[model samples]
Target: MKLAATAGGGLFLGFSWTGSLASALEVVSDTAIAAGEINFNSYLALSPDGIVTILSPNPELGQNIKTSFPMIVAEELDADWTKVKVVQAPLDTNKFERQVTGGSGAVPHSWERLRKAGATARHMLLEAAAKRWKVSAGTLRTENGFVLNPANGKKLSYGELATEASKVPVPENVKLKDPKDFKLIGTAVRNVDNHEMITGKPLYGLDFYKDGMLFAMIQRPTAFGLKLKSVDATAAKAMPGIVDVVTFKNNVAVVGKSTWQVSKARKALKVQYEAEAALESSADHDRIFKELLNSTDATVRRKDGDVEAAFKSAAKVIKSEYQCPFLSHSPMEPMNFFAHVRPDGVELVGPTQTPERARDQVAELLKIAPEKVTVQLTRLGGGFGRRLSADFALEAAELSSIIKAPVKVIWSREDDMTGGTYRPAVRYRFEAALDAKGNMIGYKLRGVGMNSGNPTREDNFPSGAVDNLLIDSVEHKSPITTGPWRAPITNFLAFAEQSFIDEVAHAAGKDPVQFRLELLDKAKKSPVGEIKYDIDRMRGVINLAAEKSGWGKKKGVAQGFSVYFSHRSYVAQVGEVELKDNKPVIKKIYAAADCGMVVNLSGANQQVRGGIVDGLGHAMYSNLTFKNGAPEQENFNSYRLIRMKEIPEVDVHFVHNGIDPTGLGEPALPPTGGAVANAIFKATGKRLRNQPFAEQEELKTV
Candidate 1:
């Protein structure tokens, strides 16, 4: 059955195609949004009592988009920021277009749309007052909450005219305030949700609860292709507080009154699984990648000049192979979800990147109308692409629908690590040719594993678009499943490519930052024939980072510099480090980014810093291993993350081009891995290629 239609006449949609309840869910539409009282006036509502309610459509995952997005609208509406109280918007895609938040596009893409919302509402308020007092609309101006007509000395607060203004038509082509006139856009504002976070409120999925809610835990097989054969419900059902032992598809779920009870029951339940080919191990991934490198079956992403002839005729040749291990997301809060299912409808609550997707998936699974499904989004402890999958939410929906009651399913830390949608492990083979003058003339990159494969069809990134780029992927083609991770395959490819460039710089006796800038300069000025990048802007970030980090000057120790651009954002990083007791120590980090017009400087800065720290953690101490097709890394004790003390001081600077904004969250990440590796090379003369550098041998500083 058709669910709801959006204001723009699009169907609100939901689904769980991956057989997990989460993958199938999403909010497709909400026509009521555009027709509602608050909808006609921008997303913010100011009452006579001086109370302000800010509608936050996207999930707040500690990125500060919650505060920043509203700030853009509030600035245009001339609303008092301090008087604002923010609430998470429901899964209403009709009202909140493109509500799926990821890729750092939240603020940059939504800035204009949200500002118009505010401006339209403000215009309506002024018009209402102008008509009431018989004055020109232009003469009736609004400030804070009051609308004043100076000509007649008549004034009315927004609260007094709220009902009347609701009847006024929403203005089209409403004038937006100039950026220069903004009182808060470029300024640093504290996160509106920070206080609730620090005080530990019930804002996250883990904190969600409902009366008579049961907790469920699923027992998965030991290997990817293994299937559940049989289970003895007797033992699990006998456990105190355990409700029932039900089998859904292949796995058995134990439901109980508490998470611990359910988990213990699931573990104790006697279960057996059919075994399939267990040959797909970590070592197998390495073998398949190597085969791809050795094969001639490659899809060309980009090509310019006769690169082959350039290499053969040139003076020098340099080659390198780099590898990166699969890694886990490891959000502080393990993946969890709350679901309530009844004969009439279903309710699902969780921290998710795609709320609308969750709604659709669950409805399809239950064979119910889309309107019967409701998804309540919670603040994510951390996403990094793991939450992008609705696996946990889907599982809860499925189990709750079967159990005919409200249920919350929580994956233990072990389950979270071993069960995570891992960032694909990768291998890169790079070859370059240089002239006698130490100028690079030719380059080729052959990527293996998933990097050679296609990204999700939904993302729309052309598969293999880099000039001289070759992608040759050999999927294991087994029953094993995987999904995208933070930066996904691109992150893996970036480390290898950027680090190899650093190696080339050292071989040619050139400054690393200067060497990259030259390439970017070439791409920008000349016609590359539809190359997917802004070369000049890329160089701008590199130069900005170099200047800010004192690239050529030795302040106290060694530093490494690197630059990379992706998802429409450009970033350059400088990592300051020192070698002590055979380990690399990061002293400081300087980051320069160009994502266009600055919306929230503070939030942008914070996102860059966080991405850097995340990349640093992956470089220093993160890896996901496998045993007989099952992940071996089961928890934080094994999969290390950067702690508070290990976090280096991060300084972020944004390069303003006075244009539209781009993504800021991810672009800053890929370069951090390469920059840190380059710096470690300086401190220890080691070119550490593979990840989890903590286990690599340390080089002595000369």
Candidate 2:
């Protein structure tokens, strides 16, 4: 969906895809949305009692997209923000489009579409009031819940004209509110689920339970390459509260009346598995990376100019290697989903980032028509790209189908850590060639990883700035599964790329901030290749970050600078480090983002802060290794997370603009590792090339 915001907040439909817009809105007819009563299909619905309920389509995953999405509709509807009750909308593919949430795309995907919904409803209300007064809608205006006429000083609440508005023709196009005239937007509105959350109400999937529903616990293969061969569940079935024991595919599930019963019974089951592939370990991955990095054969992702010639004639050549261990997507709430597979249809309720995918998967597994499947979305405790995979939901459906009973599959923390998709372990090799004048002439990057796609962003920053650049990758298909983790490749790439750029700048005897500005200027003016980033916005955030952090002027403290553009957002961060006991102590971080517009200031701030903290903690102390195709860090006992006292004060700044908002869920996270690593380098002369910096001697506490 190609959408651009016009000067007057009008939605510009420049859909490049064939028949997508037509097919997406096929469910919404003019009269369907013109109903006088509340419609759950569309986002906005008004009642005769002046009650406004805005449906949030996407699952709430602590990113605050649910609250902010509804705010968009409410803002354009001119409804009282306090009066509107936001509700989680179920997956109605016929009625809603892109009900899934991932890639930090919830806002950018729903922005224009949601605005049109609210504006169209407002247009209907205006016509309803105009018809009642026997006047043209041109003279009618709306404020709060009332449609008004300035000439007569008379107005009618939207509730009063709800019935009459049902007959008004839905406008093909309605003028969207200009950003400058926004009333509820840019305000620090609290999260709609804040009260329910703080009061410990049941909103998350872990809290979801249905009457007569059984709880099932599956015992998956203990190792990645291992497959379940047999399960001796005779003893487990005899245990107390154990309803049944079923073997589906390779997993052995123990079903019971409650979580505790099933969990306790699962321990009694003796599951045996055999290896289907060679058992691989962390040491094996390191060997594979070393072999791939040195191998001449590699897939060239992007090539521009003559890289070999530029490097051969260069006056200086610098080379470095960075590596990161695999990471677990340990969401606070372990994966859980409720599924009821019946003879006629199937029902699925859970916290899933992609509800449609879950529904379709379950339907396919059950050999049922797609229409026979229904999905109900619940609040997610945390996704972090883990919930994007419908594995947990599918497990529930499969078990429920075989057992002929509704069951909720709950993953213990250990099960989740050992049997879930992981962030791929990766190694990046970077080489820079400089001319006699210290100008970068040639740049080369080759990434080696396990199950990572491409692992290179060739069109990102510094790509167009350089005259000669070559990007390539080599992948090792491991038996272990890996999927998107937060910002995906950029989460680790930004740290390596930005840190390398910092090194290049220092080697060229230039300030880090000024050096980045120069690159952005190069990309903006005369370039080499197609640059995907907005140079102006990148420059703006970089300058803003430097200005806000006192980048160069600060004394008795070391500061490092980094910036990255990801998920349609540009974020520049400045990190400060103070040496204590000869160890780099993170003091504070200043973040400046150009996500175009601010939807909710409070939520946006929390997002940036949370991303920074998460990124910092992982880069500094988190790592998941494999000794024999099994995760080494299976729980918090072995896994390291940043403590409250270790968290630095995060100061966030947004480049306020009238442009449509992009994404904040993942963009702010990518640059954080780079900033923190750069700051550590500034404090200590040694460079930390590996992730989970605690593994490096420099970061080890004395």
Highest lDDT against the true fold, candidate? 2
TM-scores of the models, in the given order? Answer: 0.90, 0.94
Give per-residue CA lDDT, model 1, range 208-257, as digits (tens): 88888888888877677688888888977998999988898877889999
Error of 1 at 391 (Å): 1.8
The lDDT per prediction is 0.74, 0.85
Give candidate 2 regions above 4 Å deviation: 1-36
What's the count of clashing pairs in each model shown? 27, 0
lDDT string for model 2 (624-667, tens) is: 98878888888999988888999998999999867888889999
